[model samples]
Target: MHKKILLAYDGTEEGRVALLECADIAHLLRAETHLLAVMRVPSGVFLAEGFVPDTVMEDERQRIRETIDDGVALLREGGYSAYGHLACGEPVEEICRLAAELGVDLIVLGHRKQTSFASRWWKGSVGISLLERAPCSILVAVGT
Candidate 1:
């Protein structure tokens, strides 16, 4: 029984599908829902420049905040009470950290299929990585 669920929402179409699935599961189990949005600074940005500008970082944070807020609002509109959380860093790391902190029973995420093998290989997979490090069970909702 999932008493608590953490959903990693990125404000994308794929994310929306995961959100819907998570809502249904949460409704079924009567679980507390949490939405997390991570703000990640590109490694290339740090490599190109010695430091990231405060304005740039702030802008990214604002975007993430809005994204999380929107997710929470959507859940609320759907009659689900949910908590929103925001963090800055790697997505997988942030999700794991929040799940541990919240003591969530399950973590939900959206998966976007990559058609090109090279693109998939170069970018790696968050879902695969989460499987190795997540503290609890994970559900990856794939969009059609």
Candidate 2:
């Protein structure tokens, strides 16, 4: 029943798994697919410097752009055309904002299993946060 789907892709192995799964699901549902790549801005960017260097920002953007392009290509290879979006900021915030804007029926994400509680605590869990804040149903493709 999903008419539109948003996939949060980060070019990780987990992301590739999600992309493949999403491609199948999208094809089955005849859904519009959107691939989102988020560039995480470091907290230090808001500190004394008040901003990241233009060159550094550009580099980050370019990297994210490439990641999005790669995702699009993968989807195309799978026989599904997808629109790619690049967002700069926190993952959950950007994902929620775009899901709301796109009115997507489902949001797909890739997650790597963390064996240690400390690791999860230090890094925080975007998937957990998204479960609370996301505007649509979420499907997480877990990877080893």
Candidate 3:
């Protein structure tokens, strides 16, 4: 029943695992797959006292673009119909917006386990936020 699946890939180890799982599910369902890499703008860029060079921002964007391209290639090599997308914004917001825009049936994410309670509390959880705000179903693949 899942005709359109969106995979959020960040080129991390966890993300690669999620990509494999998403590819398998997509193939099983004969669904079209889309790989998304969200490029988070550095907080320094927004702070009045902080100075971020244009070159640094460009380099980061290029890296994210390469990651998305690599993820799409991996999916295609695995025999799934797939394409790559790049979004610039907060990860949760970009993911939700893209899912809604594409009218996707499901969104898959790779979740890295927090090692400490403090870290979890400080950074919050993207998976949790997605569960609450995503426009479609979400499948989170936690790294072992």
What is the TM-score of candidate 3?
Answer: 0.93
Misplaced by over 4 Å in model 3 are 45-51
Model 2 per-residue lDDT tens digits across residues 82-101: 89999988999999999999
Candidate 3 lowest-lDDT run of ten: 44-53
Best by TM-score: 1
Instruction: For candidate 3, list the clashing residue pairs, or say none.
Output: none
Candidate 3 lDDT over 16-124, as tens digits, reads 9999899889989999999999887787576575766778889998999999989998888888899999988898999999999999999999989889999999999
Candidate 1 lDDT over residue span 38-108, tens digit each = 88886666745588878888888898899989999988888887999998888899999999999999999
Give the local distance difference test score of model 2: 0.91
Better model by TM-score: candidate 1 vs candidate 2 = 1
- Predicted candidate 1: what Cα RMSD to the true structure? 1.4
Worst ten-residue run, lDDT, model 1? 40-49
**Candidate 2 runs further than 4 Å off:** 44-48
